[model samples]
Target: MTSSTPQTLYRKIWDQHVVTTRDDGTALLWVDRHYAHEGSFHAFDQLAASGRKVRRPDLTVGVADHYVPTRDRAKGSAEPEIREMIRLLDANTAGSGIRLFGLDDPDQGIVHVVGPEQGLTQPGLLIVCGDSHTSTHGAFGCLAFGIGASEVAHVLATQTLWQKPAKTLRITVDGSLGPGVTAKDLILAIIAEVGADGAAGHVIEYAGSAITELSMEARMTVCNMSIEAGGRAGMIAPDETTIGWLKGRPAVPQGQAWDAAVAQWQTLKTDAGAEFDREVRIDGASIAPTVTWGVSPEHAEPVTGTVPDPAQAGDPGRAAAWEAALDYMGLAAGQALSDIRIDRVFIGSCTNARIEDLRSAARVLDGRTTVIPTMIVPGSSAVKRQAEDEGLDRVFTASGAEWLESGCSMCAATNGDMVPPGERCASTTNRNFRGRQGPGSRTHLMSPAMAAAAAVTGHITDVRRLGDVR
Candidate 1:
């Protein structure tokens, strides 16, 4: 018998793609697209050792972002470890006849960004990547998630994966957000309220007045961190924003195919009267510019708030954890948030470095000068070129912010752009774990505007107070 309960966009897609059911209650789901990065080296190595060929070359794509140096794009060779991984991926793709977008290709960028930009990420499709932020593609109303190395190998050997269905959680944010508050702020607040593991073993469907009002880029920003919040994936129903963004993309269908694709996508939304395993509602107007002072994304607060006092924490274990984080971060309770100084500002990452993000940052930096070292790294070469063509680069340069080539530079310090020991930074990257940006480097997570404000003031300052851009 067919289920009658209202289904989330995720469940509808999952149910449609289920190929077989196992005795263990897991279903074999077909994957439409599989994205691989330098991190997929282990999977490629395993396939080679097993004398197995990639099962579906047409469905697989490879890119080099996580380990490729952003500054040295002209270099044909990378560091030894990265070089070997790149070599393996190239060889595997060639041997398997898989389509790969190499480093030299202008289309090459971060896998997550490249997939959507190329139109590979479409509504109602199952997409997987080796990197965790793959959920970014779910903004198109698709089912997307990150897979483990072993799972990567399994998918490469077979175009299907084993998985148990996850329950759905609906997060609804109503009302309009105040000025200076962005989708980043909304998600940060949700993570803080729910804790890091709140959505474990669940898929989060974001619906509400606030989410509906967000641009496609903003929706992507919120969905990108679903994994960090312990959700399998995050998705928003397809709407005009999604269609407008997908139109004319290189990989998108054209003419009659396009019309048919849109028609199918229109059916991908949640049915009326659908029921979710859990539901949550939040007021969008109450959200403020958020920043993380502790190690986890859940440990975030408003930019104007004070650091939490370990002594004031009610739970002994939590208090100890707070004390440890405070000690590691060199933060004191009762100190004004504005009093915290920052030595660096990074305005790019897989989480917040899209073209729209660059435009917002450029607006904030216009006619302003930054005292701290600030840098803006576009997510991809295409985004970089677009920013340059629009003269956004000039605005950043005028503000004393370094405009750099694309790739994951300074996001994780994988390529030598890192904060010095004991230095503090306001960054736009997703994670703020210990030593994430560099060894002993303290990172305070903020939105692009907040990062820009801190860059100009050389401290953790409130961005809303900066007034209108001239």
Candidate 2:
């Protein structure tokens, strides 16, 4: 290969977006889309302090997801500070001439979820957000990642950000996933194989038969957790699958322009024999439904596996981590995960709250009732409305799970859906960090269907053993 030719899909995108090269070797990259939530207030404040407005309001959007309550959630139901933050987003977006999807907006949802569904995420775009899950948009073949508040302000003042190019890595999974396994399980297994920071300082591109064949939403689930592995971002080459997913979505290009865009997108794939600095491969069929046995996302293993003994950690640091995590989780070395009982279940989050995810969980609960409290939070109001239309909400309610409005919900306790301290919950959210769900909350990360099974049995049961998978 010639050095003149782009080495990979990521390089191709980066080369196209670089506005200028700085003396320190950083490049000012033209951001094609910018997404923000309540947390972006700090950046907007900086913009205000400097007497500047959003440079390209048309490319920016503000949201009120993290601070909005998911329960009988009216905009006024939040505490004063939270309410003010939401209000600040509204005022700031309006003052800046950018649109804000306030709590009442039917479009209001997690920034990552809304970006893709609204057709704001597209192949070859350079996207940034104040939220880390912004990488989720990379599933559409975009080079998307999170930026800090300071960088957000920089991008607000100028439609570009200064950044160094990341090294490229390819993670490929072959064959179809086994019964009851899913994109969630696949990603968990990948993390377990490569450790939490395996992809550090690199952008990972997912490929292989199983990944390419997944529905767009499933691919989003995989990419959303890229940050968990310390990836700068995660992406898949756009194909007919991507073009089809965006064809009728809101805000996408139209008519002849759409045709031209598709033609360009079709060439966005990695060229034959193009080099990547690193590569990892996994047999998809070997991946069973997996769950985190410890606090870190990489501490995951198949549901049928036993808890790791701290002595097996092979290093002082990991051994200490395992010991602490075991103590925090009320688990013992060599304990079988299936024997671990749970007090609650969470079957929603940007990672698993899409319509397909809800349906997957509901299918497992057909004519079933929960033995423990379960909460179902849709990723967006649009998803909530669609689930209701399809009677999927009824399936959740029928099984004694609470059906709630859109928000981050149990994914974080910022909205008041706290899991009681000392109690265990099988959650579908991305992170399982200490106190991530609430003070002293123990979160076991699993797929939506696995969470549903655990809800009914009050234990970490494998969904495959429950019955024929839908």
Question: Highest lDDT among the candidates is held by which one?
Answer: 2
lDDT per residue, candidate 2, 1-470, as tens digits?
A: 36567468998899899889988879989999999888899998988898987889999988778878887675465578878888888988989889878899998887888888889899999999998888899999999999999999999999999999888899999998888999999999998988899999999999999998899989999999999999999999998899998997878899998889898898788987888999999999999999998899999989999999999999999999999999999999999999999999998888999989989999998799999999999898889999999999888888899998888878977767789999898999999999999999999999999999999999999999999784
Off by over 4 Å in 1: 76-78
Which pairs of residues collide in model 1?
Answer: 6-274
Q: Which residue pairs collide, candidate 2? A: none
Full-model lDDT, candidate 2: 0.90
TM-score of each: 0.97, 0.98
**Candidate 2, which segments miss by more than 4 Å at Cα?**
1-6
lDDT value for model 1:
0.87
lDDT of each: 0.87, 0.90
TM-score of 1: 0.97
